[model samples]
Target: MPTVPASRVPRRRTPAAAVVLSVAVFLGTVLSGCAYEYSADHWDDESTSAAPPPSTDAALPQDPHLNEPVTGEELDDWVDAVLPDAAGQVFQTGFGTLEADEERKETTAQLPKGTYALTLACRSTRRVSFSIENGEDELVDLSLRCGTSRVNVVQLAADASLSIKVDANAPANFAYRVSRI
Candidate 1:
């Protein structure tokens, strides 16, 4: 008997059967992973597991290095804590001079729409706070040195004037002078 070639044999192509088998295999695979119940009585039952609740312990504390407020005894305690027991701090006392360019008469102290220049010098053993108040005459006052060696230079508005007195006895270590330029 002669062996027949596959191309010559009667080919029975059942497209419907292949399609049905493929759909049935796919449905079986997909349904295996998922599930559905048909019993109406069991559908209402709730027997599934529940998730555990979250922990509610104490909260973490904040760091103490962030510039805590010091007052009264606390300030004294802090000064004492930081002060070294040894002597010789190399304390130097001197005067520093500053000048403002009179050409452009304006400053960034948020001065009003006007022409003005004011300067003050303070000589003291401690620092001085600067303050600026807005009004008819923008006031500038600086805590001066102990010797009261504070000088104030003022150039008022065009036709405007001010009575500025430079007190040289504020006793402050640092000299702070502000001028509108």
Candidate 2:
């Protein structure tokens, strides 16, 4: 009897059969776990799956001018209504001061095309940051100290409107002075 070398043995290809069998086994295993009935009556039971009808409460009145841009006079009136003491304060090149309570308060003014300095001094017991915005954009965001002042200079190439908004993290009373230089 002649002994054949190990390298001379023919290797039969079974990868295709193995792959097909593996895929069939995997699909059978997955499908066996999903044995749910497909009947409309199974899901249409009123007692088990009925949602309550929506409440028929009266609709709230919507503001007509809610999306309108605020005019200078309207902004002035809003400031006076919220912070009555700060009303009628002029924001000229001189000095103007305003007090802010726990609620957010705003002051709006029209600025000419020039460079001007702004000074903000707030006496806040709680931590807070004041925001200066032009339209929807924030120009200055200042973190106020208890008894200190911060100053910033802004330049306007075109005539624009600006609004100063005071916000406190906690309930606080803050007195801020705005001076133009």
Best by lDDT: 2
For residues 1-181, write the lDDT of model 1, one tens digit per residue.
9998777778796999999999999999998899665866445546454444686656855344322333456545543443323232212112232122111122233333443333333333333444444445657666543323343344444433333332222222222333344
Give the per-residue lDDT of model 2 (tens digit) for 1-181: 9998777778776999889999999999999898767777655756666676787657866454432223356544433443323222335421122333344656646766676556554433555577777777777888876345566777767777777766665444343434334
Show where candidate 2 strays beyond 4 Å. 1-101, 177-180
Q: Which 10-residue window of candidate 2 scores lowest in summed lDDT?
A: 92-101
Cα TM-score per model: 0.20, 0.41
lDDT of each: 0.40, 0.56
